[model samples]
Target: MPIYSSDSDNETMPRTKLFGRQRPIRSVLGGGQVADVLLWENKGVSAALSIGMTILWFLFEVAEYSFVTLFCHISITAMLVVFIWCTSAEIFNWTPPEMPTSILDKSTFHEFASTFHERFNQALSSFVDIACGKQPALFFAAIFCLYILSVIGNYFTFLNILYLCFVCLQTLPFLYNKYEDKVERYAGELTREVKKMFRRMNSNVLSKIPRGPVKEKKAR
Candidate 1:
């Protein structure tokens, strides 16, 4: 994109994000491990997570196993393996699995907790407005949101939809970030063409429709 801006100074500008975004993608994604996995910065961890999700999907969707049952079986197997390893390590002098000193970093935990708190506070504010009848717009907006969710729920199970969204998050942003200029150019062209077509349609078809009320039956 930088090279494109240099080559076609009039056509494209430098330092522009997709959709004219203001913030960097990393900052928008909380600048964390999640962003790394999505952006393919840590390919090994990303691949492992992708493979794990695939296996889980196969187990739940193809094997028709309930989540609770599958989770319990997995937990039992992991515990058994770890217990055996720990027990046999003393006799065989095999190395034991190393434990992390901190499972979740303090910053990450605080950020996660604060996000929940903010969301709850926002929800409460909306609810209060609704209860006091202060903002009818909020009430209608809540209904619209519920209607949209219900429509989506008709087509997809919760897990299925969640998995599809996650897959998109993994692939779409990476591709867009990669081919930003081409995507933006094409998208802009398509938008202009669509608007042109709509205008043509309006002039040719919509204009011909009768607008005024019909004359009163020729004074019958």
Candidate 2:
């Protein structure tokens, strides 16, 4: 099996998948930069995110620090450092660090807002449909998931959940990218078993269920 890569930019090269994946792992991950970080191609960024999450988890989960308290402490420390740096720079006739407005301009904010708006609208539409019972199976699935999450929430703090999710996100993608051939074989077998069970259920159980008459829409 040819290992997938962001470097496989040639149009003639056929895209590979483990089972049902359409795009390259890099494309699924967004782009080369994101794939690089996740795949350990960029060790610096991966390490930074890992270390940052660990520290945050330690502070919030282990230390039991409130977000407000942490924010205040961070702000005070940052402001104090800036103040001291400015004062020292003035006394020693040295240049001080300055942030440019161009770092986060209107275009970037607009792009972010647009992306958020699209995703939020999509989620809102799905939520509305699920709540309205447009699809009974989907509605029940959502309910089941929410109930499970509620039960889990009772035991795990938000920070714990977030940290766990972060760890999984960091690890799973890399593992899948590396050992995708083996994973694909396992996934293929699992999928076949699941489909087989579903077929049996449909034939043995679901096929016996009574169906209501279809309501035909009247022409105005």
Candidate 3:
């Protein structure tokens, strides 16, 4: 009898499931040779662009009333013209737009619901476990900080604060990750110096304090 190898069988198998039922989506829209170009491929370029855009947005509102009006007028008119021409038989013949399809079909609603339900339950359980775990000082501090922000947010636009946070999250994480090794080393050195300082203070205090039981000197 010949022994069948699982690895060989797996390697020979085709990725037919995606194509079997529903048509597989192309990696790039409109089947272009080059796939999507990422705006943030380079962290430095992304940071520069973000800063420039933010400054420009602040100095002169990018979506000024006149600019927004012009944009809306042009886009809406073009879309309307194309849509009417496509629908009417009196003009150039064109088919009605196809209804967009989703990865999860209506038929798979039950499966989608079950999957989300399971995921939500797992997330809730994990969150509770973390919240109840040892060393929750940072976690509680974060909650307190958020509460303070929420209370004081009545004075300023909450949306503005949220947007600033969004920008920081995008920009800061990349920069930190790039220089993480140096940051860790510096932090480690600082921690050691702090520990040494405390140790020295502790030793000096102990030396100054009387350690042994003293015999009373006779009426000196």
Among all candidates shown, the one with the greatest TM-score: 1
lDDT per residue, candidate 2, 180-206, as tens digits? 888876666565567567767777778
Residue pairs clashing in model 1 are none
lDDT per residue (tens digit) for residues 95-127 in model 3: 655555775366446644665576688768756
lDDT score at residue 26, model 3, on the 0-100 scale: 25
Local accuracy of candidate 1 as per-residue lDDT tens digits, 1-220 = 1111123443353444555678877666556676787788889878887889888888887798998999899999999998998889878998977867996589867875775576688779878888677878677888788899899999888888778877897888678767877887777666556656776777777877889876777664
Point out where model 3 deviates above 4 Å. 1-39, 42-127, 130-133, 189-220
Backbone clashes, each candidate: 0, 0, 0
Q: TM-score for all predictions?
A: 0.65, 0.62, 0.37
Q: Can you tell me which runs of candidate 2 are displaced by over 4 Å?
A: 1-20, 75-136, 204-220
State candidate 2's TM-score: 0.62
lDDT score of residue 129 within candidate 1? 83
Q: Give the best candidate by lDDT.
A: 2
- Deviation of model 1 at 92, angstroms: 2.4
